[model samples]
Target: MKRFASITLRLLISGVLLVLLFREHDLFADIAPRFHSLLTNWHWTLAGMGFAFLSLFLASVRWHIILRGLVPSLPFPMVLQAELISAFFNISSVGVVGGDTYKIMALSRRLPGQTMPVSVSLVLDHLTGLISVAILFTACMLARSSQWNEIGYDMRMLITGYAMYVGGALVGLVISWFSFTPSLLAWGRRTFPRTMGNPKLTGLIARLTQVHAVFALLWRRTISAMAVSTAMHAAFFVSFYCGLRAVGGAAPVLDVLTSMPIVDAAASLPVSISGLGVRERTFEALLAGLAQVPEAVGVSASLAGWIFSLFWGVVGGILFLRAKHAAHIAPEAQCA
Candidate 1:
């Protein structure tokens, strides 16, 4: 029933956005020509796909670094396989929960008795990824502040609010790091005896504490992981920039860098089906409002990005199927 509700919501949001986007323009008239143009520029499309793949690879490497602190012996190939499978699930399902569940289940099967630590590693990897996005978004906004006057007062206010939100999140993380003491866990256990009395809850709290300790121990590597994450995000923005160029849109690099984070953050909300229509509209609004591009060109560029991402999704689907076959064969091989 819950899953049904989720799917319904996704479809509703996607349908509404699709209508809103195409209500004024002739979809066949506007989009078909742009798509034809995009196909003619195969070189840019291929380049964008290459950058997208590079970004995914970098993200897998970043996850491997985080996993090393928990399971040092875990192979890179295994992590890469899991990451690809996760990506497939993320695209197919409504939200990231599907991908995260796949990661946890796959890792648990591979490493018995280590699920707790494996889960911790996944959480930390996600946290670092968010931090990197916040940092990059903030930096791009600052670097492009001179152009803010062109975007109007409303957008300027939105940018200021986003920067403040990111800054507050960073400060909160630092405070949490300092405040994560063993006594905090002890106090929670004592205060909520009934709640913590559940063996599962107690175990989860214990694992969280262990995660905090491990994070402190690997502070240097954590910083390095953030660097790698930033590079991954850079590749992502570059991929979008290349896609935009492919569609004959000459938006500046800083504009792509600044606008995409907002688009991405909006799309990641569980409001639509993989952010299908929401993403396109966001691209249209941001690119048109900030970069003074035509709404049609903005939508075209967004469609190009969607095409590149869908190509990778197809690859991830193949990888996910291959992993299933491998998993099936492993038991037979072990028995033989």
Candidate 2:
């Protein structure tokens, strides 16, 4: 029943976005011409795909670094495989949680006794990636503030709020690095003996303290991970720029840098399957409104970008299926 509800919601959101996207323009007429134009500049399309692949490689490397920090003996190849499998699930499933669950389960099976730390690492990895996105968005906004002054009030407010969010995240990371969460837990137990009498609550507090300690231990690695994440996201942005050029769109590189993050964030909201219509519409809006590109060109570039991602998702699907088969055969082989 829950699955049914989720699917229904996803379809509804996708339907609404599709309507919005095609309302002002002819879908077939607009996209077909731009796509045909892309064939003329096929080399740029290949370049975009290369950049997309590089971004995925960097993402796998960043995750491997985080996993290794938790389990020093964790092999890079294994981590990379797990990352690709997760990406497959993320693209194939209804939402991103499916991929995260797959990743945690895969790692937990491989490292039996360290599920808690593995889970913590995954959470930290996501948080750091989010922080990097926020930082990048803020930086780009500031860099183009002069040009953005004429943008709508809503956009200005959104940028300002995002800047505050990035600042808050940075401060939180610093506090967590120097925090005495363990001591705080101890003090809470001492001060609230009655409350601490509940084993479940006590256990929860203990786990939180442990997670916090691990997080602090990983502070240095988090910085490096964020740096890699920034590079990875930049590569993705460059890929989008290449797509725009391939489609003959004249959007500025900085405009793409600043706007793509917003479009990507909106598209990742779990409202539609793999962002689908949401991504196209957001891309169309940002590119047309901010960069003065044609809506058809913007949508075409977005579709091109999606095709690049779909190619990777297909690769990930093959890798995931292979991993599943290997896991299934391992015990049978041992018995034989």
Candidate 3:
């Protein structure tokens, strides 16, 4: 019954999302007629897509660095594979949960004896990445102060909410780090008392501390990771800049850069699966007053981003299936 209810809810969400997406825009007029223009602008789109994927790869590499401290002997390819697989699932209707779980399972399987530590590393990797995004986006907004003032109230609220959420996460991490043993142990015991009863489980829990140690040891590298991510994120903005240009729109690069993170973050609020309706509305609302671009153009650009994300998700699906099949066919040790 619970599974049925969950499925029903997701379907309902998808329906509402579709309505939201097509609500304001004339789907046939705004989207269908734009195909030729999009094709003509394919160069920018392809370039943007390439840069986006490259950024994701770089992120995976940074994640691997964090993982190394947890499971020193784990293969790099294994980590990358897991990340790709996870990212693929994350973009689907299952949302972030499916992807995160897939990632944890991959790490657990690949590192065998280091499951807990690897899990710890994944959490840390996610935390650091979110922090990195916040720092980079904040810098982008500050650099384009004038543009910041022009953003709508809805967007400002969204950005503020995201900032608070990330801030809260950082606070939680600090709290966890300082008082790691009791909170984590209690949580683990409550959730997995049977596992906690095993000696190996105690060792796994201890390994989590080792993972934290790894994070401390590599704290410096996190700066480098954020630096690289900043460059990549800038590259992402450039993609959008070129994309807008390709479509003959007049929005400035700085405007797009400053506005995008907030808009993107806002659309992620589960108001729409894959951010379909929500993204279009946010983009139109945010960009309409600031720039002379048509709502359709902004909507078109958002649609293009959705396309690219779905493409990657499709790739992830293939990997998910491949991993599933390999799990069954391969030796148990090979999974590790």
Model 1 lDDT-worst window of ten: 176-185
Against the true structure, candidate 1 reaches a TM-score of 0.90
User: lDDT scores for all predictions?
Assistant: 0.82, 0.80, 0.69
lDDT of 3 by residue, 1-336 (tens): 766566566657767765766666777866667645667878876876776677667767777777665566767788767767776766775443667688887777656676666677776676666676677777766787765666667667766776687678778777767744556777878898898879986786676676566667778766666676666566655655555655556687667776676676766675446556676777766667556578888877766766665666678789879878877788876767
Residue clash pairs of candidate 1? none
TM-score of 2: 0.88
Q: Candidate 1, residues 1-336: lDDT per residue as tens digits?
A: 888888898989899888777775557887667777677888888899888888888988998898888789999988888877777777788643687898899889899998987888887887788899998997897898686777888777766776787788789878766556787767866898899689887676676677788788877778889999999988987888888888878888888899888788778888888788888888888887788888878887887887787778778889888877988999999999
TM for every model, in the order presented, reads: 0.90, 0.88, 0.78
lDDT of 2 by residue, 1-336 (tens): 888898889988888877777766677777767777668989888988899888888888888777788899998887777777777787788753677798888889989998888888887788778887877887887888787768877667765665676678778866764454767656767898899779998686666566677767887887899999998898988898888888878777898998878788778887898898988987887777777788878888898888877778789899888877998999999999
What's the true lDDT of residue 288 in model 2? 75
Which residue runs of candidate 1 sit more than 4 Å off their true CA positions?
95-97, 184-207, 329-336
Model 2, runs deviating above 4 Å: 95-97, 165-180, 191-207, 328-336
Instruction: Please state the error at residue 245 of candidate 1 in Å.
Output: 1.2
Total backbone collisions for each predicted model: 0, 0, 0
Most TM-score-accurate candidate: 1
